[model samples]
Target: MPTVDPTVLERPVKLHHLTFLDEGEEMTVGRPDIDAYVHLPRDGAELLKRLADGDTPEQAAAWYAEAYGETVDMSDFLETLEELEFLADDDTEVTTAEPVRWQRLGAALFSRWGLAAVTLIVVAAGIVLTQRPDLIPHYSHAFYTPSLIVVMLTLFLGQFPFLFLHEGAHALAGRKLGLKSRLRVSRRFYFIVFETSMDGLVSVPRGKRYVPILAGVISDLTATALLIIVAASTGGLIAGVSMALALGTAMRILWQCYFFLRTDLYYLTVTVLGCKNLHATSRDLLLRRLRRLFGRPVGEPISATETDRRAARWYSWLLLLGYAVMIFSLGYVVVPSLVFVVGEVVDRIIEQAPLPLLLDSVVVAVLIVGQFVVAGLLGLRERRLNRTVSSQPKAGSR
Candidate 1:
């Protein structure tokens, strides 16, 4: 093994490694992280080398497919490279030095009037809906598309802010527990996600675990309620859309709970399990299934990543089921809207109820079902991370 230069970006670096095949020419692999490149498997490595030398993911995928005479999904290459921080501006910023603005405010507010604020929002929404029954329906009908757009954008763009609030909760809880806390961005499933470095978090007694786990939700609930209130007051199409958007966004935030994808809820559950690394174990289990399907020899034995993945595995299966439901839901909800989107082009060639729409719905439904299945399977992984804290209650830090 050779040590790599840490600062080796901005130019091509190369390294020669043993090929996956024993009878191999010098195989070259490019490591964007260390900026080292290597060529092996002659032709295969040549293509890979070209990809590493700055070909876009699309180019790389095409090269792999064309050279190997196999269809290579670009997503795998792109996702891996992106997660490895291979893209330009790849480094995600990590923060812990300065306190997040909302945490400071939420702490004081939560300590003081968190309940009152929530009550006011609920009361206000109820009164508005009751007093002006015609309003919501009118708004829902009039600017539904714009409203939906706003909601979807909120779902996409607000992820960062929401994530921040989550880590803030962790930091706040850490503060309460007298532990220093910092926020860092780490790659997960090809995306950057915020997390509280558990170095300090883990060192603290297990009784304090719930604070960090529950912090993000507290932040989400508060932000959502406040946004809803603010959106409610504004009157007009924009205001109406705002209100709907806030509610929809809030629901998306809450959607985290329905699945166990490394969520706060899953972590909380894990702390109760006292089983470290349950996720890794469950992942092994999943891979074993894949191997069986492919007739490949079984590789590694299962260990643990944590109970969270196991819980998430259950959720994955549920999501797969949702796909089955989505078959219907897509026909009912998503597809109709999509029809309005491209109905003009489709209407020309197809019949009154275009086969495209039905086909699209079916595809979407299958996708939804697949998601549920994956979630269910991942949920079963059971990282057993928190099991180490078995001396404490299994009910959680509470």
Candidate 2:
């Protein structure tokens, strides 16, 4: 086996809530995206089933495993039982130790830096909204006319700035848990984010998972709020800028809810379900779909196939919706946009187009590509660090 890192869970990864089952003995929380979970041992599974089957976890581990499987370690079983509050005579109160000095400092740095960054964004946006008031709904224009595309593009591109803030929220949440963070870049490449690392967030308690999940939305919310404040402060809706900004922020929040695209919200949903790798669950669903399409029997591991069926069902639906969105965004928006820019660039390179146009087009591409490239590099580095530490062996390992 390849070496792995000891601090695998200590890297900076986003955490979210996934569905949790509090079986009197077996409690498994799945994170579908990561495709794993903290599962109560099989020995405990019998008791869990019994509890659900009208028994209690206070039953001896012997009996529980007798009904389930022999996978449970007795001590861990008892501890988990205590965690679910099934062991009345014993309970592990949420064990929270004081954070280390470095942790406190990191927490401070994270909060301070995050706030500063957000403030900068708000001020810049305010200035733009104020200056480009004319971009807002004009005093006399008609419905969905010429400015719609420009405004939509502006809003679309503008939302990218908040992407980091989303990741920052995840980083900050990890920091609060006394973990060091490995922040990754935020950009989309070919409808896929080849680089985005949330490798270090696992060590934190499940209860603390919401911060990373909600961070970007928090940033978007904060930004929108600030924009609203500035717009209000300056009097009424200046131009269409306020409306556009408002709509953009609203859409940002809505995007998270869509769940069709695996945005931060998707991660959060998987976290809540305790499904570690939603990608895996999704793959499983896709496989079943493929089988069905081929007119094959679902058979055997059919029960396993049905595992997390509720969440799984949503996965298929969201996936369908997601691909539709992808086709529209990619073909209609991204491809056309890229083609236009590239055509203009090629023309300039061959001296068929003006240098000024070429220079501007190249600048936009560089700016966008540069952001993703940097983020991807950071993500790769995080994974490498984790793999390095996790490869170490235990003293008793064979």
Candidate 3:
């Protein structure tokens, strides 16, 4: 084990530029350069502030003791900071973060005029939908073509551009606030999803964080509105394609409501409730309850804030509901779709249908099955990778 030097308490402390945001009785302190953040009690935040402001660890600890009538272990605190990479070593150069690209565009989109324009578009779309309710999204919209292959291909292939737009909205929103973000492919349960990682958002004030978090949802709504208008104004295959796109986008919007999956709205809920680690805390709470019910030995008590523990009591029920919904969706939606496609394909093959007709059925079947196969392979690969990474030795450890 790596040991902390006793002399660290006597040395003057240096730190990279840090951002601090007050969250009720606690404060969030983070170094954006490293994208590391932690919640600390008000007293702890004050002590760290003093240390960063040129006070040696000893002096900061003495002040904390006098102010709070409790002496803190400065050595331990210094060690924790070192682990978080918040401390700046004298020999190490501190580099500034590069400016994020498209920041001006991000700023414009979130500005008052930009938001007003979106509001107008949404209102206009609503009026159009009211006049032409046929444009509304329905599962039937997905089958706009006679050929199942064309429908499947269009829906499958077309969703990526919208997905990119959705995730890009999130990235742009974060960039507006000078926070960097990156997009990556990830899995949500068995479904592959694109996600934007904006780790530096923790350093941003709570109120300003919502735009970045909800930007994707807003983008979805905008896309759906635009497509609905197109479908209403146009006819033939163009209208059909637009309707299909609208349906896909609308479904993506609905997916956000699965808050238990730690979706964007989930983070918004956590922020609104002023709860930290609610999902993990609720999961652990639920597991412990299940263990106790079966008279099994529950592990150690969960370490979480009182707010998180209190919220978890109710949030745990939502987690169960979320899982139930996932299962229900699989049975109600996925199974039926698979059965229909397979039955159709089998009928076409058995009857020795026309070459074009038979080829379409075969392609649809392969595409449908291939999606699940890819998802399964990706899931297994991610699980093994996670295991390997977890098994590796952490820094400063043997």
Candidate 4:
């Protein structure tokens, strides 16, 4: 390991917004621009602070000895920081850019006042739902009478905007914290997911990160609350429409439980635990354990960093719990609901509603087929990118 010279440590390094967040049990050193962070002990943080303030190794070491009555390993400490790429020489340049326009918009939408309004609406909605309990949506509520086909079609189409709003909430949360974020569509198997990349959230204080991570869930819950309120107040067509939306939003909220899919709740757990690579590392660990349990001739598992290993050891249990919940939901919730819908559609066809039945069948078929089509396209793109990368000649090759 390379170590910083005691003489050069006197010079200050150019750093991004370096801040220490006291997280009660621990402290976090964060660099917002790079989205890099590490937890540190109080003394370790003080060491870095001293170095950042242009204290030479010898000076800092003396101060540490006087304060703690023990010698600090300045050489190893500097090497660790260097390895983490937290150190830069005087020539290193730091750049700044104007904040994105969306930051202001996010501030407006997710302001304290806005959150309070959402809370009030939710409370009012809850009271209304308790009073007019019939307004509460059930799975069968998806059938808007006369034609279940139209109700299914409307729900299938209407959810797109709500899903967008869910991702938008994530983007807004990150933006409100002055972090650049992007919204994109991704998929896990046949399930479509709207995601926001807020990698910069890692650089923020751990407490501050919970809001961004949980913002999507909040948005879903709030939308469902508003829908229930509207359904209670209105009747006829509006009530039907609102009830459909309410069911859609409620399902979306429940879907957050599949934390194995790296849902909002998954990110929230990762943030709370201060885990660096829990998802991938814990998944690998779980696979290895499963192989061993099944007496499979598994190859040697790739080793993870000590930090990752520690996090994975605990996080693997959460993955197991997620799998159990997913299976139960599929068997009890999803399968039963799907069977009821299919049976209803078939019953409608036999009752001489052939045209509506055909339309509903087509809608279901298109959605099922569309998900596979999208997955295939994504797979092809990934393969193409891999080929492009692999075909490139080595740097030293002629």
How well does each candidate superpose onto the true structure, as a TM-score? 0.43, 0.52, 0.91, 0.71
Which number leads on TM-score? 3
Q: Cα deviation of 107 in candidate 1 (Å)?
A: 6.7
Error of 1 at 204 (Å): 2.8
Give me candidate 3's TM-score against the actual structure.
0.91
* lDDT, model 3: 0.87
lDDT of each: 0.50, 0.54, 0.87, 0.75
Q: Among all windows of ten consecutive residues in candidate 2, which has the lowest summed lDDT?
A: 8-17
Where does the lowest 10-residue lDDT sum fall in candidate 1?
14-23
Could you tell me which 10 consecutive residues in candidate 4 have the lowest summed lDDT?
389-398
lDDT of 4 by residue, 1-398 (tens): 44566665555554444667775555677665555567677887887788778777778888899988999888777776655557765677644334666888888878888889889988998899889988777886687667755776778898998999898898888888898777777775346677788766766677788878888888888899998888887888888888888898898898887778888877877777766667888888889899999998776645455666888988899888877876787688755756665676677678767685667775775564566578678767768987997896422101
| Model 2 CA lDDT for position 208 | 63
Kindly report the root-mean-square deviation of model 4 from the true structure over all alpha carbons: 6.6
Error of 3 at 213 (Å): 1.6
Q: What residue pairs are clashing in model 4?
A: none
Q: What's the C-alpha lDDT at position 294 in model 3?
A: 100
TM-score of 4: 0.71
In angstroms, the error of model 1 at 250 is 1.9
